[model samples]
Target: MNAKIIIVLVSVVAAAGAIATFYSQAHAPLERVTEGFETGYGGWAPDADVPIDPNTGQPVDWYVARSTDVSFSGTHSLKFFIDGRQDDGTIWIERKVLLREGARRVNITFDLYSGEESFNTIAVVCAYAGFKDPEHEGELTVLGPANEVAGWKRYSLAVDIDTGNAQEAWVAAGISVRWETHMTYYLDDIIIEVT
Candidate 1:
């Protein structure tokens, strides 16, 4: 092999590698975060009405508190306390943000922890709802009904955002349980990326 040919071949390979790296980084998804749950609720607002717990005979709104006992990625995590009323209630934490126009997609990911080995009760459940635009009536990707217990687990959902006719989007997470169910769920490290 000629010395010059070897040099040219090496140069070509290096150039190709550089180009590939640039392309990958350039096309990486951008953050359109609704919440990370790394700090408090990260702007998530409660959207459920407080109901009287039939068992305790006390009014309990959907409760969210910072938990230090367990976390998916940090020292703290959000704990969602589902009431024991058993009225098919869902406690939601939601954030409203404006979606960028044009064809777009959103990816939602989060970590969860369940205390029990399995959801034995009729009210046991795990559920997540991704972003939705009311104006466009866009479909959302929901991930849930998971009965994972004892350890930290990650969940994700990817859905298209019809931004052509939609400007605002709602990002939410919730726990839905049957009447007479009582449980505490953990959530953390939530992320929303757009592309």
Candidate 2:
């Protein structure tokens, strides 16, 4: 009887441990951004240009380029430069992604730096989720007016997506600056994870 009790206890403990491990693994944070600035801007594109493109006769987006002068990690960071001259000012980098079912929340994080240490509110980190078919049914969350000076400051936001509908969902995340701020913003190591 003593031997049987020992075996039963041992089996129960082992099973419990296995279950815990599996739960942790299944719930482990997963990177949702297919590419994050680590490899040169990660396919993010500018949109809703304020001024005309001139050549194309279309509203041009903010000028974006990869930079090596400053970075959170690795050798590449995205640089956004804008003058406070445009009439309709809205400058941002956005990447769209299709999220799978069962995705509960999205955690968007990135490192930011500014050229001017002293100034009014200039930059922020933002994320958005939109439904494909309906297009308008989704959420958009923006976090932080990055106030760090002389170095890289990390900013993040966790957005809860309504996964009850089960239709395909689109996720977008990036760095944005208050238009007409007339400042240079550097962004690096942007990462988005879902659980």
lDDT by residue (100-127, candidate 2, tens digit) is 6677777767777766554555655555
lDDT tens digits, residue span 1-195, model 1: 999999999999999999999998667764467454556677777555346666678766568777787887758888878665556555656676556545377666777777765655433333333344222112222355534557766877767766767666666655666546667777788777766
What's the lDDT for all of these models? 0.63, 0.62
Top TM-score model: 2
TM-scores, each model vs. reference: 0.70, 0.73
153 Cα displacement, candidate 2 (Å): 1.3
Query: How well does model 1 score by local distance difference test?
Result: 0.63
Candidate 1: residue 23 Cα off by (Å) = 3.1
Could you tell me the C-alpha RMSD of candidate 1 in Å? Answer: 4.7
Model 1: residues >4 Å from true position, as ranges? Answer: 1-22, 34-38, 49-60, 119-142
Model 2: CA > 4 A from native: 1-6, 34-36, 49-61, 132-140, 165-168, 174-181
